[model samples]
Target: MKKLACTLIFILLSCHLFAQDETHPFTIRGLIYDEKTNERLEGAVVSSGDNASAMSDKTGFFQLRLDRKAEKLKVKLVGYEEKNLVIDFDDESEVKLIIRLTPEPILLQGVTVTGEHFTEEPVVNSYSIHPGDLSKVPQFIEADAFRAFQALPGVTTAADMSSQISVRGGNYDETLVFLDGIPVYNPYHLVGVFSMFNSDILQNERLYMSNYPVSYGGALSSVLELNSKQGNNERIKGSAALGLASAKIALDGPLWGGNFLISGRRTYFDFLTRMIMGIRFPYYFYDLYSKYVYPLSKNNLLTVSAFYSRDALGLDDDKVFVAQKEIPNWGNLFLNFSDEYFLKEKSSVELKAFMSRASLGVNTQVFFTDYYHQMGTTDTTTVNNYIEDFTARLTFNSHPDGQALAVGLEAKREAIHYDWNIDETDLNGMYIHPLESLFFDFAPSQYSYSGDEFYLNAFVTDKVTISPVSELTAGLRGSYIKNLKTFLLLPSFSFSYNFLPNLQVHLSYGRYFQNTYSLKERKTEAVFTPFMATFFPEDKENIPYSDHYASGLVLSDIFSEKTSLEVEGYFKDRNNLA
Candidate 1:
């Protein structure tokens, strides 16, 4: 009887302990959006306690699983108000939520709506800047978007006369520039003294020094992406500015159940310099930008945009004692159409088609006259180069239980044309008498080349949550070049861990490749008369590539809520550099 009672007690105690150990686990799924604009918010943090958390993806969706012991859930994002909710896993195994966050008002009186604060970003090597920030810095005549980047760490320019940025230790050509969803080639005006981007029309700008997302390619060093305003959909609004060097006008309003934005800028330095300095300066530039956004349905949106820019600089005859003349001109035209569809609450698809054309031309003539007489020799050279690109891309983004996935397919066709001509005539007596040279015969030399290239690329990236404080991102990209008959595979990975609420560590590795190279003179004498000759790929078995290794530590909220510090180190090994 005693042994039977002991066995029964032991069994009951074991059963109770076992029951307590089997705690119920439930999943929380949600979508976050802006309260005012109803636009999806990316990179928002959702946390359940300190050990369970997840970040929203590009589609503004996130999912987290936690045990029944979790009592409260919190959502936090920069430039927005935070929210907390009570969680009850006992009621259901899964809970779905839609969260709306209100934007925080700026304490400064004259400040506009800037993008998210940089210190709150989870990515260690990424930074965002707003147009309003550029206005605080004193520039030449007007604020410049590209010049603001020079104040950041690890960003350098070769000279003060140029606006081309080199991130880390990479060359100017290695950096990729993007406007909206389209690529921009030669994004500089006035020989790199100013960027093609206008500060007044910019909404936000992002810079990735290394470990960029797989959605961006073709560059070996860094990526610079800029976004323009989508226009006010409620009422008509306009702004105009007149600076010492240039003037700009912008207008936006609702039209036919959609919104439209139009802006234009022109430089008057040709007229200003001629009046103020009494110099016959003949240089001017102008650009026009327009965008239209329409809601096709409750779940779909369409966007159309177009941009055009032209630059001209020349010196007419008799401007100098030698009677020299130079006419250099360049221009860019871009058109883009994009469609976005929300397939589900946590999934979406986007399709985009774009075309870009850039052209450069130079015409130079020099006359060498005899000091004693008006007789002389003349030499003339002309160069013309053109590049055109057409691209189509489709991408899908989804948020599953504990991971985010992005898959994309892209196809591009590019055409290149180049032409060069030179003509020279010598009327000097040293070569021949004036009467004999009056009927002299000379033949000009000419060269021309044309080619077409095709490219196909596919990529997929995944962000996996290891734990509340740890996450991993991995991606693979494959590209095929039809003209070169070559294939390239690139792989990248990054891991981040938060040891404390304000301290984090990150490490990343990536392999990048470039198939096209530009040919231009880099001598100091060519700076004043700069010209881009052509872009071509050499005949070789292997293409140029670079391997990058980077690590960094971030400390947020250092001395104040708005202050942060980041220390990073990177090493790159390159082969077959151009």
Candidate 2:
């Protein structure tokens, strides 16, 4: 009888302990997703109040075991808002959760738009400035992007009449400009007095004065990166402005479950003069820009961008003094298509295809009399310049182990055509150069060239935080130009250290290469007519390149809020100038 009672008591005690264990599992399971796209998000970390944490797998699934006293859980991921939840321990059951996080980009330096206006934010880089603040500065005819650049350090304008900028004592052609992720061979309008970009459409602009990243090549001096705003996904908005020289309008709205934006600008001096005064002003320019964004799926997004600009000048043959008719026209056109895909493993991939073309044409007709007023002659000249490029690029970006890694490949096919012909009589020369060459007459001049070349470029960059007070960025770029059959390896490095809470130091070094060079032509009356020239190997050894070294010191909050003082110096070594 005693043995039976003992066995029963032991079994009852064991059952009670097992029941208590089953009641409090202390385990939580979850699946994370993107709030906007409804796509699974991997690499997210889920942590409890007890400091127990687990990372989501490729399937966005995670399981965590928490302390019995833990009542709160949190989830965190880069480029996403943090999510928190409260646990119900009273339920006494395993907790399963489906958490969604909103996407948020981490910007090192940029502006924040509140309502319809943007607020200027202090940037760590002294060269970085908010594009919206450009309007507050004084304007020459209109708010010009290049003019704003001139206000920055190490940048200078060629003249009051020109908007082109020279950086670090480098020529304008050495600087590169990028709009919406594509290179713009020429980004000027209205005789180089205005930038082609419309300020209303610009979201941000960043200038790298020296030792820029290696992801960009084909420039020896500096880089200007401009990004246009995406359309309003929730509502329709429009803005219009009329200045003394030009009129611009922008419209953005939702379309077909996507978003679209279109902006345009045109100089109206010629139009107004023709309409009000009934006179031929003979000069005008117009520019158009458009972009479209669509989410093809939860993990894929598509975007399209297009730009066109033209400047035209015309003169009649019945002019009073010169009796010469001259027609000059130049324009740029580009189209870009891009796709971004979100992948597992805390990474994303972007693919882009772009087509660009620039065209220049000038035709002249002159009817003149000799200096002695005895002979009459007519001379005609025609010139054409064209550059066309097709480019394909693939880029992969990832955040792994607290470091940012970027790798990309680009292939471009460039074609160029240049031709000129002059038809003139012997008297044409005597009429113009009577004192110097009255007895000698000039012969007809003609030249033509048409060629195409392929280029391949690849780059990789890694940004790492060395310590709490220091960071490092290093990259390398390799480029191969088919015509020259030469390869170039460019490397760049940047390091930043915080000497104090309010003081910092920066050091950078970079090597850059350029395959295209700009040639400013003086054949026309226009002040500036720049044409692009590509490499044609004679000896296959003359490739232009430059090395840049720079250092800067910044002191923040010296006097007031959002105020800082910075001093920087740079040196550039250019080689093989053509």
Candidate 3:
């Protein structure tokens, strides 16, 4: 029996060895550089996808293997950025890269690539934001990815805090952000003045306003997908930049004896907050990000990613009627790893695991007519809101013959905690606080507790070309909320009719939902009422909100496919918010 067991173990070990790698004819080579400074970046981490990795010496150069029928090769590092390459591994290949970094960006995930989808490309209600579009926007000199969405048809930015974005008139929390395959909640800061994400580290930002794939949900209005550069297999690279709030740096290259790449970034805003705010208050924040990828084999790739950020705001008010100091604390963290396995020339599978968490806290103490902390009025109040989402997902992508199909299953769990005081209100409809104090940190809270929620979902979609001139896209998605024991089904489809090769009429519609937000609902949720750093619970008993969405588009080939005019209109609705 012992001999037989040893034989079986030997067989399994042999199989594992065979699955590791396949040596082929060609080798891959490349160079890496700084995207902003246009200088060679040395010590950049570069890897094919797994095991093998090499850092750029003094020259930012790299080299890796290319097995026949090979899959994806990625390169990553710290201080600059990462780059990814998808190639047919039969012959030798060479590529160059420019890594970008700006101050302290929050977190960076993988890039999502799309250009020509046979489904006639939703001509009307959609717009594509490419790496170049980021440069064309006047304010984009800062490379704030989410802000660019505001210029599109259905997008808007929170007027005061520039970072928060709303799609098709939807609420700020209705939107969703995806980094690589992981989810990011509240991807901005200080009423949205700065995007929590750094553009220099990202390769592309795709904003889905009215039309989005079923692979994502839990947000009501739209989806913003950010793609990071895959680590370079050919060489190491890096970059750095300075911004209004902070400074940052990054690097990407190979590992695993030259088969993997690692990348990272860190910001210092706490070091810069000395800047004054008209003597009313002082503000500051900071963050760090890192990613790594390994090429297990030509057909299989592995990756890991992580991020962290923290922000603080302090305000003081001293007048004839009020004396108060308001302080808010916020931050986020995320970690994820994914595997891309190819089954055939046209079919592939992706397995991923990730964890994300965020928190927003406002601690204050008010004063009374006697300048003493009031009982109910001046009582110390603390509103601490935190959200943590852990997820695991599996996806299958196939483009067989004329059929485009994708299927996936995902599970996400969330936890939220809010603690604060709702002072009395006046006739003008505002919470009237009775007192104010110094050295604010919630003035010390009395009662505190937390809440938790979870969700499980499955989705699938397909695009089939019936003929030339016309095509169809159909998809279905459903999510089950473990906390609410509720399930929501979303079905989507789009049609495009081309009267002329350069002219096509398109129509589309879909249902959407989003989780991971403050749940702050007020009477008038417009661009005017800025974030006040207080906790206001929306009347869920009166208005329950779970999801939000929009639908509609236009496509015209006024010029070549490279440059065309597109016009789109959309509408959205939501229920239950605070």
Candidate 4:
């Protein structure tokens, strides 16, 4: 019996070896580029005749393993002609080829590339904004993202003159804005006419109405995140536009084996009014944006971005009595650095360092002249508020088979300063205090506050595929505030089930916390003078938290080929109102 068993094992081993010899491991690796421009193309599909396929990454690199029986490979990309190459295998197991595809005019007209598809399940209460669609909407002066958002459901603007929007009954200040993975406290120019983001430099925008992921914190209402363009690596390109209120120019080109983009926008209405008419338009706004991208290697990338925007209004008239000079300005500045390293087995690590400052203030001087036209009794009033944030974060993400995990550590420090000295009620016949007109039953006086707070946060999230038609996501976050000497844990959960091929239901719950609270006297929210809740002793137990419960139903491909319907109900319980 022992001899018979040994003979069977030897026969099975010989058969396995013979099968291995019949099929050799074959792999193809290459980069895809444009034939005319020599620019790298991302999202191109490469496939072998035997059904093996791979997609090009952002860097236009792809790798595919195919069966030995496969003879030829084909590449297809939108707006480009299909390319075919014959296989010429040598003794080596791997083959490298640089492929180039020619651009072709699409036969179909009015074929827009909207990212939304009815067949795929999406996050609850989330919307993706295509940068190209912004131009289709009517523009007040130029394309404004915030203005475009007003047409979306659950979003409402304050007025036609203002671009500020409220989401689902939440205050405008409750919304958190991010640019290039960094937080932006103030993302407006001229208080609301135009957003700080330049449409020419924007690549993508996403809005999360509610029940957002724990990866983003310190917000109770919504999140708006924007990503900038990566620039052209092959050749130099520039564009300029003239508008009624503003003028903008953008330039992008290859630099130092990488790419760079720079853009600037300034309202020329001040100059036009002065040049055409002899009137002095003292109010104008300008903003500048720049970014640089470099690839350290095939799997590593480095990026740096900076943004600045300012709105300045100056008035000085010595020709009239009671000569007065007033200057009111506000703006935001931020610098961000990010490094991403891709690992094996569909994993990556991201490290980010960011610095940002938001400042708003006004300085006014009034002079009383004597009967002889001699200047006397000069009074000066100043009000200034600034918030500076320094942050460093490291995040790791892995997707293995049917599950995904994300863990991150973030350290943030914020320094807030407020100063004001006002002796009178009016400045050049206008309200001096920013909120004096909004709040009916309030009085403004000397007030000052200066302090700093440090926060350490750790978060972990897991997404698991329960079955072919269901998914579950759960997350936990822990935060420690040094000034408050407190530690808190927050948990979130989400579940989605496909009732049918075209219908889906999603349920989610989350607990959110906010350390920064606006200081206002009336029911209305103030745009400036934000204070940390930790500064007040009474806020120890009332750290300003909210519990969110939401459920949504999605119907895809029900009405039309490219149409979808979504319905959602949500409830929010908020505490510790400032």
Candidate 5:
């Protein structure tokens, strides 16, 4: 019996040894993706030690046979990420894995808004500014987007020399300005000294000094795009401050447990100005902005934006002789609304609508004056003008890699009907739209005129990798421009060369055109001065402009581009409506 027990134990040990030798040939496989985006990686390699290795596919997938003796695996990828996997291949069973890569943290130092939209992809002729760096620049005050702009190369000294702000030799008229998708004809509120935007609430200010993509056209010289804060989805926050011309307060936070972003900003400078200036009456200026964003579902966002501004330069009440009676009644109004909608990510499409009005009227207190001007003969000039624009547009946004892109499209229409009626004419008083004078001789005492314009434009840009040292971007744009009644095309191209890891070289070329022109050409320095609206006998005389722009930016991570001492130059030529 004892002998039988010993033999049975020996048999059991033999069986165990044989089982160990038959170790199951297990295989482990996984796909790699960006942590935040869940985007798959391409061309990644997973090697155990050169001999024991496997390469990952474009989808970041790799399969390696497990050896009972092998223990660890090493992974590497160019320009992206590298990592090591700890595994014990001693088991005979199959192992599945989802490998993760750690992204390299990079400190940015360049133009403020230019680089924020697409960091992964190579953008042509764009400056990327980080708020962290902007906060440290000494020459510019905080929140002064334009001030930061003045520090870049390619910026002309003309405006600075003339004590003005002109970017890339572009006249103030030639620059296109926008804030939170709202077209801002005038970016300044306090005589060019202060921008209308609140820096504290400002998220980014992108400047296309030249060679902007097909997605952005219509402006001749430059494009200054201001992005307001989208509000924190994770927290509620607000700020209030008093400046020289105004005092403002802003509030933003999450709604419904952090699914929605709501924010609002308002300024009561006139009230503060009146208090500080020791004025008997209120001589003030004020502006307000509000925005709400909600994610209806994954990959979809809905946003509502609003703005309001009023400038009361000064007010006066007077009595004038009208034939046989003394009449007294006077007030002026400056009001505006800017709103937009953004849908889709990177392929973002927007519907934009806005209205602006500046009115001055005088007449008897009891008359047909419900937002209407008075017509009389007592040295009184009534100027009333209304402008409305609606645009649906698409924007082309790309990341450092072509794998992600942001594109948008839009349609736009605008109407202008402004009038100038003269009562106490200087007999020879002359008032004309700056452009009208260039085309026709006119007087400030003219009647009202009207104009209607429409535009439709679409743009798409993609980020593509050329090689380890270079990135390429290709973009296309199509447009339906009215008033001239035609379709136009704007194409743009740009590339960046990381000549050295620390130094980046950029080049961009683009075609840009303008379908509309501003009536207020750049002459009025004072607010109370008379405003002259130019008239056109026919809209056909107003010719559309065609322009071409090229630019380059040299960026560095070791130094801030603004203060890094860059040297840039550009050349532009165009024909004015002569």
Candidate 6:
């Protein structure tokens, strides 16, 4: 009986010691904004004590968790004044705040600073572009997103007039583009002269050339992610611009305790060409965008976004006397709905659904006449192509201690349809010259093809800090293709070391895969047609994949705070060309 009493007393003492060792951390959530303009600020750094730090997201939201013993917080960002706050919180407590930072004027040797500015972070092989800086570059009488990307290192274009970028020796179709966490197919307009994205509506743009996070997949070369701005929460505002090539308008305001934005742009190139050069170019393009944001609560939000773009080109019998006419048109439509809920100050869950459709059509007619026989023949052709995609994705993010963990799952369904009809008469003796005879084809054919593909992807990524000056990121992605009946696994890793306050080095390696293929005729000039095809693994021996290796050194504030330089070298090995 005495021994049993002693055992019970020791058990009670052990339980008390375990409770004393457990620590309940405090969480703080906040939004950072510009003090005078009330605009949300992204990329701001928020640090609590010494071990906890977070950067503001595209929405200007930031979250930090700290131990009970922490007492101070600091916020810093480029072009803004640094601010410090006193923290007073108990165990298991939560706090919310709104911080406003004032802008600071930059002076370089007594000269007012103007032009492009750059800032460097710790992410490896990653770059970001601001919308304000895009307007400074000259491109087709308007700022272009893709054109701006082409100016970056490791990115090259096929031709001077083409905006299709090939990154690190990868093909044009190897790059993946995303807008608001949704994939975008056929993102070009004006025969690859410009991108469909409107510069005025963009909030954030990021490019990952190598070792990108596992949250994104299904691409072999690179990733370009773009986010649209949330409308003004305080007041209503509108802007309109009229340029030589296009006209655009934007409206944004608060609605029903939320925010809304609408923007549209249209080009009048055909009309301008007819008036100035007496040439009926017969080509025009337009795009429309809308976004709605509803803040359900302090930590929950809902977003709905829609986009539409159209391009039409026609050449009737007005300009050519040979009785020839061709009309080609293409367009894209996208819709997305997303919901975000915060489970804790440093953890969140997001659910998103999106649909995208792309279409192409072509109609052509040609006629031939024989003077000796006084006879005429006609050739007509029609082609129609359509592609549609439906996708759903769920992502979860958590920050425990100083490390970050993210996991996501995505499902996609894609459908494609292509049909063409061609009817031509024998015109071998109708044309006088051999060159003219080549235009009068003698062929009659019809073909139709359809396909459906389903994809499932899951990924997990972790960011760990091994020391104060070094950080590492490890990720893995798994994907399954139903049509191909194949499974793929991709792995990514990156390491960054800050050797000095203003100098850093980074290394990264990753494996990537792609299931879609873009087919075009091997010609000297660019061709805009409906010739894209999908790969079926059952019929193919190998799937498309690429391995990337890159290393870079970044120098920040070499001469001044506004001056920064990045030099990177990369090697890529691609197999099973798409």
The TM-score leader among the candidates is 6
Mind sharing the TM-score for model 2? Answer: 0.75
Instruction: Give the residue spans of candidate 5 off by over 4 A.
Output: 1-123, 132-143, 154-164, 257-278, 317-378, 394-408, 422-443, 518-542, 549-565
Ranking according to lDDT, highest score first: 6, 4, 1, 2, 3, 5
For candidate 1, lDDT tens digit of each residue in 473-578? 9987777788787777789999999999888899999888764554432432333222343355755454667888999888887665556678889988877765
| lDDT tens digits by residue: candidate 4, 480-524 | 878788887889999999999878899999888876765433333
Poorest 10 consecutive residues of model 2 by lDDT? 434-443
Give per-residue CA lDDT, model 5, range 421-445, as digits (tens): 4443321122223312321234344
Q: Model 2 scores what on Cα lDDT?
A: 0.70
**Alpha-carbon deviation at 210 in model 1, angstroms:** 1.8
2 or 6: which has the higher TM-score? 6
Kindly list the per-residue Cα lDDT of model 2 for residues 1-578, writing each as its tens digit.
23433543453344334333333347677668767644456668998876667677534656665447468889998668888888775766467688888987545335432211111222223354343467865789888877877766678875777888888888777888888778887678875788888888875577877777777777888888777766656567788999988999999878898778999999888878889998878789999999998879756779899999988866443322233444667779999999987654335678999998888786776565556655366666576877888999988765543356677778989887877665645422432422111111221256577888788888778788798788889887878777777777788888889889878898888898776654432233333434444444344466667888888777776654345667877789998776
Task: Show pairs that collide, candidate 4.
Answer: none
State the displacement of the C-alpha of residue 148, model 2, in Å, after optimal TM-score superposition: 0.7
Model 1 TM-score relative to the real fold = 0.78
Residue 173 displacement in candidate 5 (angstroms) = 1.4
Error of 1 at 440 (Å): 33
TM-score for each predicted model, relative to the true structure: 0.78, 0.75, 0.66, 0.82, 0.63, 0.85
In the range 1-578, model 6's lDDT, one tens digit per residue, is 23433543453344334323335466778989877556678889998776678888767888876566457889998778999998766554777789999988544684443334355464687667764667766676678777777777788876777667777777777788898887777788876677888888997687887667789887888898888887777788889998766899999888899889999999977778899999877679999999998989988989999999988866444322233344667778999999998766466789999999887776766564465544366766576777788999888776655567777778889887867665634422222222111111221256576888898877777788788888888887778787667677788998889899888898888998876665432231223322243433334356778898999888988777767788888888888773
Model 1 backbone overlap count: 0
TM accuracy, model 6: 0.85
TM-score order, best first, reads: 6, 4, 1, 2, 3, 5
Per-residue lDDT value at 146 in model 6:
76
Judging by TM-score, tell me the better candidate of 2 and 5. 2
The lDDT values for all models are 0.72, 0.70, 0.56, 0.72, 0.50, 0.73
RMSD of each: 12.1, 14.1, 11.2, 9.0, 16.4, 8.2
